[model samples]
Target chain A: MSSDKNNINLKLKVWRQKNSQTEGAFETLDAKNVSPDASFLEMLDAVNEDLIKKDKEPIVFDHDCREGICGSCGFMINGEAHGPQKGTTVCQLHMRHFNDGEELVLEPWRATAFPVIKDLMCDRSALDRIIRAGGYISVNTGNAQDANNIPIPKPDADEAFMSATCIGCGACVASCKNASAALFTSAKITHLALLPQGRVEQDQRALDMVAQMDAEGFGACTTTGACSAACPKEISLINIAKMNREYLRASVLKKEELSGGGDG
Target chain B: MLNFLKSTVGRKYIMGITGLVWMGFILGHMAGNMLIFLGPEAFNSYGHSIVSNKILLYGTEIALILAIIGHVTSAISLTLENRAAKGTRYAVMPKGEKASTWASRNMGAQGSAILAFIILHLITFKYGAHYETTVNGVVMRDLHKLVLEVFMKPGYVAWYVVCLLLLLFHLSHGAHSVFQSFGILERKMQAPLKKIAWAYAAVVAGGFLSQPIYVFLVNR
Candidate 1:
């Protein structure tokens, strides 16, 4: 592996689009020298600097908290979501992982629900809309409750925490051949459905969030296991299965309500 | 009810249930057909017993038809919806680095082939030339002779074997996926479930293919 002391030269093929309405194309640029210790985003920063000095338009990309925790930065690196590194986000990926004289192609997340807005930025509002539909507990808070007030089993808490690790990045959607949002929708559903506090609105949450997911034009999941593979958090595909169970239960309950034979 | 079926998850639920129903029918059908190895009298007797009761026979036929319809319609809708959702294709598509299988990816094409095979199979076996036989003072359709006649032909036997292989491909993916769709499969249980599905597919396909091979060799 190339270390920080060892610099490498590479060819970068980055997608460049003037705006959402315009067509995008790959712009080849030469990275003459780059520190192996630089993060992937920093490498892009170097390339952008070169473009600005040459009086060319700097490639635009979305990023925040370059530390990889913000969930604000993501783009396809060589047809793989978040580059070739496993469980690492784009911001956390380092130039050292790539070899010298490598040809790298970078593009935004590809999905009908996530349309490209610029060079490497896509509109991810569809995810936000699904969450808005019903991703939260409706509990009103006046004062903080003691952590031990509500007892949660260890396993359930651990699983809930795992499910809650989803960053709402569009990698799952990007990697899926069907562009399915099942993983993303399920992660949110599973996170809330596991906790006692989130159970009160569980049925509604499943129904509304799934409906919103469908409304956003994301494809149906075929359970090919690609989403979980592409997930930066390694979110389990079982979460999608769990969400299916919840959705089925909620649908059946809704049917009962429609027939006037059960509590809505 | 219609709205539920129209939704993606609801449609998947239908597909899962109907696919399982079809799997049940295939297993039972293969077991019954395996009686062919017991000679003409035994095979013919078993066939007669099954079709002897009009209610049981017609009920099963109708249910199978409905299952086929449900499975096909739901699959087509989901496939179309998925295609539309994809919007535009990536210029450079990459193979999934994780657990996707060929059977899982080509379910639509595999399902179509299986449907065509089913149509031809029903036509040749159910509506082809009839033979009558009498055993123990009871009259029965000589299904054993009919199967022999069908398998005696090289073209028919080849087609039957090919169809069985296609069915294996369809079932390999469908069996385990049905469980996943219903959310009945736990995380740890998925690997075992997949193994069971593959084993089931292999056994069913092997069993069905054995008949034609056996008949051909015996007659030769």
Candidate 2:
């Protein structure tokens, strides 16, 4: 609500840790002279500079390409994932949304599956495992084919596009009551299955992706919709339902030999 | 203990365990109810076998009552805690449509609906001639006739059908979750658990509703 850019000051309860093995605690710091136009990461950068000048170790947090596109600058801002804005990523959030002199609680993503690396950094490699198991078109490589060759309908393409927009940031897991990765895994599966290129691997994709998801120790989706609600990318929970449908269909089609796992 | 309850993980742990216990009761109850479709003789014999064994019947009923009480109490507590954490919103128009499942989000509403049906079921089916009527030196009720008579009415049968759908909705989301929450649902069990939940839900819904549908919609 403050139109005047000058009078911004805030307190941040930032979580601090030297390493994953070491214990951590919330270290309070003053966010001084914060510009209204500064992105949330830029504000953090300013604070880090202050800490370095005072002969203190800078707060460790992950950020690459301070733009929202990288999906790296995610941490719980006052118990809400990606800060208070409904759909804005942490990198995209501006100082204006917060009030001057407000105390903000910042913490690393807390989920059993997402082990903290140090401070706000986490090893999101579990998500990568899910992707590796199955998240791609499996067709043999060839030169570019015409878009018309696939003949994908507009509705299907739109749905696929929406699902494919998932940044794999693990916000869904952090926000979920069950810590489910269903939204992310489902998005990857649904995105491919909606297109002709991915149809060849539809059953395989569903089976492998789901297997990997379960293996990663992430909880199942209970349809609470918290993940979708907290997602900075605004990913839909409908993909979870779509994923369920695909899994069911694939299970029905799978032969007894192929039922266990792998391309039998 | 209070600190544990206040933590996010603690609250979820409570919700998960209690939720699973309730789901277990529903599955058992639905399984027993499915026997009704096997015909009056099969269902009545099954019912009499259980009810006639007074000790077992009493113990089972007490356990069921406890499950219901625990489920409702925990649910109320969790709801209150969440509401207190997230302050009242001030949106003038509506925000965008919520992405929650219809069944999961509407637990209280669906629970209330199911509770109404439970009371009605107790009054008309449980307390009516089906139970506690005496002759000479004994108490007895014709279970087969009671079922037939209950389903014979168009309005009563219609209500049964409606309640069965609600029960299905409740069970669909609740079944797999109970196991998952307790960390019992393993990687190997994922497919089977989901399948069993879906199949069990369908069979219960179909089997129980069919009794009334057969009497009112089909036979008539």
Docking class of 2: incorrect
Question: Looking at model 2, how many pairs of residues clash?
Answer: 0
- Candidate 1 per-residue lDDT over residues A117-161, each given as its tens digit: 899999999999999999998867589798999999999999999
Candidate 2 error regions (>4 Å) = A1-5, A256-264, B1-220
TM-score of model 1 (CA atoms): 0.93
Estimate the lDDT of model 2. 0.72
Give the best candidate by TM-score.
1
Candidate 2 lDDT, A183-229, residue by residue in tens = 89988998999998899879878877877876677765555667877
Candidate 2, B20-111: lDDT as tens digits:
65666666766786676666556666776788899988986786677677667766665554443222211121123223566765666677
List DockQ for all candidates: 0.58, 0.08
**RMSD (Cα, Å) of model 1:** 3.1
Q: Per-candidate TM vs. native?
A: 0.93, 0.61
Per-residue accuracy of model 1 over B1-220 as CA lDDT, tens digit each: 5656778888899998888878898899899889888888998888888888899899989888999899999889888878887776655555556435788778999899889998888898888789999988999999888888889999989888888888898899888888878988677897999899999999999999999999998855
